[model samples]
Target: MKNNWQLYVLILPAVIYFIVFNYFPLYGIQIAFKDYKAASGIAGSAWVGLKHFENFFNAYYFKRLLSNTLLLNVFNLLWSFPIPLILAIFLNQIKSPKRKRFIQTSIYVPYFISTVVLAGMLYIFLSPTSGIFNIMRTSLGMKAVDYMSEAAAFRTIYIISGVWQTAGWGTILYMASLAGVDTSLYEAAEIDGASIWQKIRYIDLPSLVSVAMMVFILDCGKLLSSNTDKALVMQTAGNIPTSDIIGVYVYNVGLGSGQFSYTAAIGLFVNLINFILIMSVNKLSKKVTDVGLF
Candidate 1:
C-alpha cells in the first residue's frame, strides 16, 4: 500500500484535471433536461425531463442539421482519413534525412496558421472582386463567381481547407510508427527480390496498420464535430443552409440566441452519438488488430 501511494500521487494531477475539466462539466448535462434560466440558476431551474430533447428531435431544422452533419463526417472519413497515412508512407520512403525534415516542416506550417487567418486567406483567394481567382476568371473569359455565397461550394471549400490544414500535422504519428519498424524486414524483402510496391504492400502497410486504426478510431469519435471558429468564419447567411453543422448550430443557439438549455440538449445529443461511434470503432479495432484505447 505504501508503494502504491507514490503511483497514486503521480496520477493525482491527471485525476484533478479530469475532475475539473471533464467530470465537473458533466453535472451541467442536466441542463439538457431542464428549463435552465440564468436568473433561476442551475439549482433553481425547473426540471423539464426530456422536453428539450424532444423539441430538438421535432425541430424543423432537424433533418437538415442531421443531413449536413452526417455528410460532412462522411466526406471527412472518405477524403481526410487516408491523406496522412499516404503522406507518412511517401515521406518514409524518402532516403535523404535532410529532404524528409524539410518536407515535414513545410507541411506542418499550415497547421500552425490561425483558423481566422487561414479562412481570411481563402476568402481573399476566392474573392469575386479584385481577387486573383476572379482576375484569372475574367482573363479566361469566364464569369467571376462569388464562391462564399454559393451553397454548392461550401462543403468543397471546407473539406479542402481541412485537408491542407491537418494532413501534414496528422502524419507525425504515422511517421513515428514507421520509424519504429524493423529495418531487417525491408532488407529481407530486398533479398527476396520483392519489388518496392510489394515491400510496401506487405511490410510497410502491415507495420502501419495499428497506427492507422488508432487514428481512424479517434476521427470517428469526432464525427459530429466541426471547428466552430472555422465554420463561423466561412459561414454567411447565403452559405448557412449547407454549412450549418452541429457545432455551429450549438454556438448559434447558446451564444447567439441565448437558448442555453436548447443548445445544451443538442450538444449533448451530438456528444452521445460521438461516444457511441468511438465505442463501436474501438470494439471493431480491438477485434481486428488487438489495438484499442481501452
Candidate 2:
C-alpha cells in the first residue's frame, strides 16, 4: 500500500468525487422515511416509517407506471441491445475497409446527438401539422396523423429512436471481442467447408457468449428506469399515459411538486430494485457462463 502512493494519488480525485457527490448525499435517504418539511429540513423531519412507500405502492397510477417502465426496459433489452451485436458482425464481414469505416462512422453519429436534440428531431419529423411524416402521408392521400400524440406510437418511437441513437455506440465492445476471435478457427472452418452461417453460429457467436451475458445482466439493472431526459421532452398530455415511467414520475412528484419525502421514497424503491436485479443476474451469469462480472 505504501509503495503505490503514486497510483493512489492519481485516483484520489475520482475517489473523493464519488464520496463527495454520491456517498455523502446518502444521508438524505432518511428523508424517504420521514415526513420531511422545509421548516425542519432533512435531519429534523419527523420519522414516518414507510408511509410514502405505502402511498406510492397503493397509488391509482401504480400499475400504469410499473407496466410502462418494465415494457420500455424490456423492449430496449430485446431489440436495441441485440442490434449492436448484429451490426458489429455485419461490419466485421465487410470486405471493403473504406466502405465499412464509412458505414460505421455514419451509424455512430446518432449516438453523439444530445437527447434533447433527438427528441426535438422526433417532434419535428412526427408533428401532424408541418412534420415531414405527415406531409408524406398527405401526399400519399392518407390522413396526416400526429404520431407523437398517439399513445400507441409513443413506445414505438421511443424505442426505435433509442435504438437509432445508441445501437452504434453499443457495437464497440462486441466489435472488440469479435476482433479477438482466433484467425486459426476461421481457417479450420474454411477447410471443413463450413458455410458463413455455420462459422458465425459455431465460432463467432460462441465467442460472444461471455460478453453478451455480462451486458445482458448489467442491462437488467435498469429494468425499472427510462431515459428521463428524452421522456420529459417528448411527454405531452396526449402521450402521458404511455410515457409516464418511474423517472418521469420522480421528477414530477419530487422536484416539480416539491414533495421531497415522497419522491425520495420512490427513488429508494427504484435503486433497491436495481440493486437486487444486479445481484440476482450476477449469480445467474455465474451459473450459465465461465465469466461472471461480480
Model 1 residue runs over 4 Å out of place are: 1-11
> 1-294 in candidate 1: lDDT tens per residue?
686999999999999999999999998989888999999999899999999899989999998988988898789788899999999999988999999999999999999999999999999999999779899999999999999889889999999999999999999999999999999999998999998789889988988888899889998998888778888899988888989887888888889899999999998899999999999999999998898988
Any idea what lDDT model 1 has? 0.91
Report, for every candidate in turn, its global Cα lDDT versus the true structure.
Answer: 0.91, 0.91
Poorest lDDT segment (10 consecutive residues) of candidate 1: 69-78
Count of backbone clashes for each model? 0, 0
Q: After superposition, how far is residue 34 of candidate 2 from its true place, in Å?
A: 1.0
Model 2 scores a C-alpha lDDT of: 0.91
RMSD for each of the candidates? 1.7, 1.6
lDDT of 2 by residue, 20-65 (tens): 9999999999999999999998888899999999999999999999
